[model samples]
Target: MFFKEVVASLYAWDLLDENVDHALDVLQRETRTNSTYLVALMHDEKRPLTDFYYPHNPRRKVYWTEDSRAYWRPSPDGYERIKPRLSDSDELAGTDWMQVLIDASRARGMSVGAELSHTWIDKERTRTELADCVQRDVYGNPFDGQVCFNNPDVRAYAKALYVDLAANYDIDYVMTCVRGFNPGRGEGADTELGRLVGTTHGGCFCDSCQARAEAHGVDWAALTERLRWLADGYDRFNHKQNFELRLLLASTANITSLLVELPELYAFLKFRADSLTEFFAEVRTAVKDVSPRTDLRLNHYAGHPELMGLDLRSVAKQLDSIRSSDYAEQSGDPARMEWKRGYLHNIRRTVGLDMYFLSAVSPRPKATPELVEQGVRISAECGADALTIGHYDGSWLDCLRAVKSGLDKVGIEIRPDLPMWQRAAPALDGNPPHEIVPSSRS
Candidate 1:
């Protein structure tokens, strides 16, 4: 099926009944140059905007601790459980958030899609033995509340959730986000101590990961001991010298000695990627089981797929599209723009020509019409099949109109005159004229 040349991502919470008409009108008015698709947030693994739509097996109730952590508590008695996280005044009860948003978007003749995240589980829930599938760090510490992809139960639960979403929602596509095991950015790695720990010891030595790595022929024990020795040395030095100087010395030693001497680190990284590949494969199977026609896409990071354990080429066959954040505001400098273009070209090379590539433009800090125009033009020039204007709630209508103007200049079609509702959709098999072509430089 042909992908929409322009798409918009809407937060499910923003799609209230009172403002549905106004939102549609804004989308219609802004997306004047092209027929658009809507990718809505459906099943949020973290703090959900709506009530849990899927039925729980044992019947769980959401609980909030004094520290503001949220978790699901087993409700065997089926009593009215308190949801402290949800304010009593927030009136979204009885609302089928997914169905309501899909119906509204389809009513406007826009193709609908949903986004899901797999890595995060509610923190409070992870604390419970029933839901303790959190990913472990190098030190065997669980990452905040994220579930380990290596856990069969977690994988089953995630697949079941995807299957449920596909079976229930009348949506055209699904976009999976954060489906890898990489630690969050602010996780200890950002701090001096954390950096030292990560550099010296290859982490995430959980039993499941160790078993998987061993299966892959990695010398898991030897690698772990080597990392531990390096970590211990760093720790010993950390207490003896100035912290900043010690960190610098440790980082230098880690780069110049540890990583170079240990070839297992490379194999370990590959193992991580392979694990994620297996997880995504199962997710693809689940999506196809419910409906073979439903497209599967990834909300990919801009680059560093290797760090995220994503092998785009191997996974491309299982996916229909890849939507990445362009964040064009960062493209103001010449070097940054060149890097962005190179990254886009690399994605085209990796995914081949068949899969659709969509670039998401952020209108943050500055949302001027000129910036929007530049973002659209850059994405098109960089060989994007479609460009999505992110976060409709905060975007200016004038800036959206500017996106249309930019696309118009690139000779892309804008289906503003098409009927708001249709009995039968047109054939989406053919490629449009503006379909992304591989850059000659690539």
Candidate 2:
């Protein structure tokens, strides 16, 4: 029942170079410090960085060239071409990073896991397959290229991919990311457009979503009209005099009235949550079907479970663990440790204590070694089952070393070669103890 105390997220491109042996050596050395699990990004559909490991299913045919470029080619006989996204370099052309990591992890006595992203597709490469899966906003415009969870085709594709990873790779666990609805703007509401687009719309009124809603006894047409009226009001106010004030007032009134008057809005939210739960359940079944022993974990946004359609309490039985990113750099006013504690409290409340909880921390460019230590210490104090750094690259060696020092301070064992300080500082006494404040949703 022992899981990794520390895990590292590594990008495949970083390991696809000629000096892979050196990179693996560094990884082995660092992981030995705390018996870290190396979770490598095996397939990234959002960015298409690595090659596809699974054989192409003719029914779900998608093709990519040797240089990691994705394309589509169909024949008149209902057939399609398929190829691997192999590296151009001779040293890495035939190399299989998954196998490489498996061998290396076994040799080093460390655990290895595969990280994959679901509900993401390359727009240019798989536009035909993703046409019906794209999420539509209140204005009937697509939200980038994120796939809708209600789309049966997208769900099937995701399930098949998960099965391939589980059945093929000899991994300890399978971790997935971005398995929820899009939460609006990416730049943190810094821009007016970001706020206008992100806050006003819930998302995904596509045909599949509408069909599912109707099946759930929700009045899809009426809901669609109300959303359109809201969108129209915003558009009208955006162009008139006193635009900012008018738009703000209209948006506030619309959202308030919609929530107060419309029962269908709540129903729609429930539908979305249910849809995601079902999708995840199917995925969990698929993974178990392929390899019953491999663990299944989900990486979700820490705050705003409602926006992401994540009803953790409902899906807890299907998952072995849940992970959330703790971006200490973005902790505005609170100390990084305090912010981490609040996040952990939220996750614990949502998922309860039955499942293993992990905290993934991202070190900012300006982060000092001391800050890194505080982040790790706070995660341990908050009762995190495991702690993982956001990524492993040349820039994060210092942060990794700082994490090791922090783990050592808390009496966690490390490699003998990386020795802890012989004389530790004495614990202070007679000082008022720190009180952890409970996190509030409101």
Candidate 2 versus the native: TM-score?
0.74
TM-score of each: 0.73, 0.74
**Worst ten-residue run, lDDT, model 2?**
432-441
Q: Can you give the lDDT of residue 340 in candidate 1?
A: 63
User: In candidate 2, residue 277 scores what lDDT?
Assistant: 72
The regions of model 1 sitting more than 4 angstroms off are 1-3, 33-89, 183-203, 230-260, 330-336, 414-442
The per-prediction CA RMSD against the true structure, in angstroms, equals 10.7, 12.0
Candidate 2 lDDT tens digits, 1-442 = 1224567665444455324455556545653323333333223342222223312122222223232221111112321232222344453345566666667666766667766544345554345634667787766677755778888777776676556656776777777775476654412555443343343365778889888766655677776665455445445554542364356554644544545564555555566677777777777777777687777778866365656666777666567777777667333233656766788888877777666777766443445667777776777667667777664542246655676676666765533243211221122232211221111111
Q: Indicate the TM-score of model 1.
A: 0.73
Q: Candidate 1, residues 91-182: lDDT per residue as tens digits?
A: 44445556766777777777777665443354565676634466765667666556677776777766655565566678777777754665
Name the best candidate (by TM-score): 2
lDDT of model 2, residue 379: 73
Q: What is the lDDT of residue 181 in candidate 2?
A: 68
**Steric clash pairs (candidate 2):** none
**Count of backbone collisions within predicted model 1:** 5
